[model samples]
Target: MEVMQYAEDALTINLGNEVDEKINRQLVILKAAIEKLEIEGITDIVLSYTSLIVYFDVQKTNIEKLKESLSTLDLSDLTDSTYSYKVIKIPVCYGGKFGPDLDSFKADGLEPEDVIARHSEKEYLVYMLGFMPGFPFLGGLDESLYKARLDSPRTKIPAGSVGIGGQQTGMYPFDSPGGWNLLGRTPIPLYDSSRESAILYEAGDRIIYTSIDEDEYYRIQEAYEKGQYTVDIEYRGEENGA
Candidate 1:
């Protein structure tokens, strides 16, 4: 691992240059260790696919002090899977208007069902949540389903729109301009400012997508709006031996 001054009030600790499970797990460990210290002036620890940015306040702590604190941390056994994760099952309705670019898979000799089957067949690791509020950057897209992004990006991608951009796949939590090819959409709200818990999933979590028909999509959407929908989740906590 390598550490460098990111800015006047931030530092970046790089775990690895490439994106891998071990690197991401190490990032989790590094962030947890920093938080455990509860050091003064550390305002926020922003994690990404390969590194973490520690934001600090000069009033409480200086760059030199924060760097010294980080040096004393125990970042050993980074490859050890000491952290736990919860699997969130998201229901999606693929193809048609929900995924106008669903046909883009055909260029790779894949049907929309083929794309759905491959895309939803595995659990995706939540690398980081960025690009927009509550928008998760998920890893583990099947190589066969990879497709280049659209030449002309859309100005307003619909909320809940699941899309694939180059090597990554994610959903839009709001109507935002994006270039990812739409694959489908989920009915559940990923981000709701009015809710007590704004975002349901975090960086360390894993999520699986299951194909749902249009009818079930509307049903779940309505249920969520009426405060009746609950996402299916399975926890594998380390402390509880789950």
Candidate 2:
């Protein structure tokens, strides 16, 4: 890990340029260390694919004090929690009305069958939730499916639109313009601020996409709207305490 001081008010810890399970493990440990401090001045701990940016209050926590506090943390002793995380199986309908970029994917040598097969073959990790609320930034996309974003972003990408951009894939929680290649969508609501826990998924959870046909899509959509869909989940606990 490389630490860079910025503006004497924030600390950006760079976890290097690669994405791996180790980095994810470190994030969980580092976050616990920060939370242990119970520092009154810390504003937020923003996590990205390979970095943790900690914002601090200048009036309460100075750069030296923050750095010293961080130094006392023994990262070697830090470990993930033993609590189990549920593996959610999300049903999605690829192509057709759900995916606007179906033609473009076909143009890029990706048939609908191939897309669904590759997409559903792997279990993705929710590396970090960002860009949109409850919108998980998933990793482990098959390299073959990697494609760049559109030259021109759409004026409006409907909520639940699942898209792929380069090596990453995510769903649009709400209607918004984006350049990621649309592959399909799910009926599940990614973000709902009204509920006690509005976000459906969180970091450290495992996600699996189950392919469904267009008819099933509508069926699921109707059920979801009527609060009839029951999200299926499986849990796997971590070995060590958080």
Candidate 3:
């Protein structure tokens, strides 16, 4: 790991140079450790695929002391230990009006059912959240389904619309202009300011997609809007004897 000063009140630690699950896991462990410390002046901890950016208050802490504290940490235990994570099951309505770009994949020689099956069969990892509020950047997409972004971005992508851009797959949390290949949509509200906690998922969380019909989609949407529906989730503990 390499630590370098980022600004007057922030430092960035480069955990690895490439994006990999092991590297990301290390960064998560480190971020958790720093948060547990509750170090004075440390205001925020931002994590990327292979790095952690720590922001601090100059008035409360200095670089030397912070570096010293970080150097004393032993990350071996964290590296060896298994971590418990939440798995979220998201319902999606693929093809037709919900996914305008579905035919684009068909032209590429992929059947709609094949596309949906490939996408929903695997569990994905929430690598980070960016591009827009509550937007999750998920990893673990099947390479066979990889596709390029549109030549021109759409003026607006509806909230909850799921899409693929190159190797990445994610959903739009709000209506915004985007160029990802539209695959499906979910009814769950990813972001809502009225809730005590707005965003539903966080980095390190796992996600699984389930295909639903248009009628069921609208039903869930209505139930969700009425505050009667909750996204399905499973809590998995670390492996035994880890």
**Clash pairs for candidate 3:** none
Q: How far off is residue 175 in model 2, in Å?
A: 1.0
Cα-based RMSD of candidate 3: 1.9
- Relative to the true structure, candidate 2 has a C-alpha RMSD (angstroms) of 2.9
Give TM per candidate. 0.93, 0.85, 0.94
Order of candidates by lDDT, top first?
A: 1, 3, 2
Predicted structure 3: lDDT:
0.86
lDDT of each: 0.86, 0.80, 0.86
Model 2 misplacement above 4 A: 7-9, 79-84, 240-242
Q: Model 1, stretches more than 4 Å misplaced? A: 77-81, 238-242
At residue 193, what lDDT does model 2 achieve? 72
Give the C-alpha miss distance for residue 224 in model 2, angstroms.
3.2
Clash count (model 2, backbone only):
1
Q: Candidate 3's residue-wise lDDT over 1-242, tens digit each?
A: 69999699889999778877777677777888888887899998888888889999999999998998888767766676667668989999998989888778777788888899899957998888888878988999999889999999999999999999999899999999999999989988889887766987777788899999999999999998998987787887663124
Ordered list by TM-score, greatest first: 3, 1, 2
Model 3 residue 164 lDDT score:
96
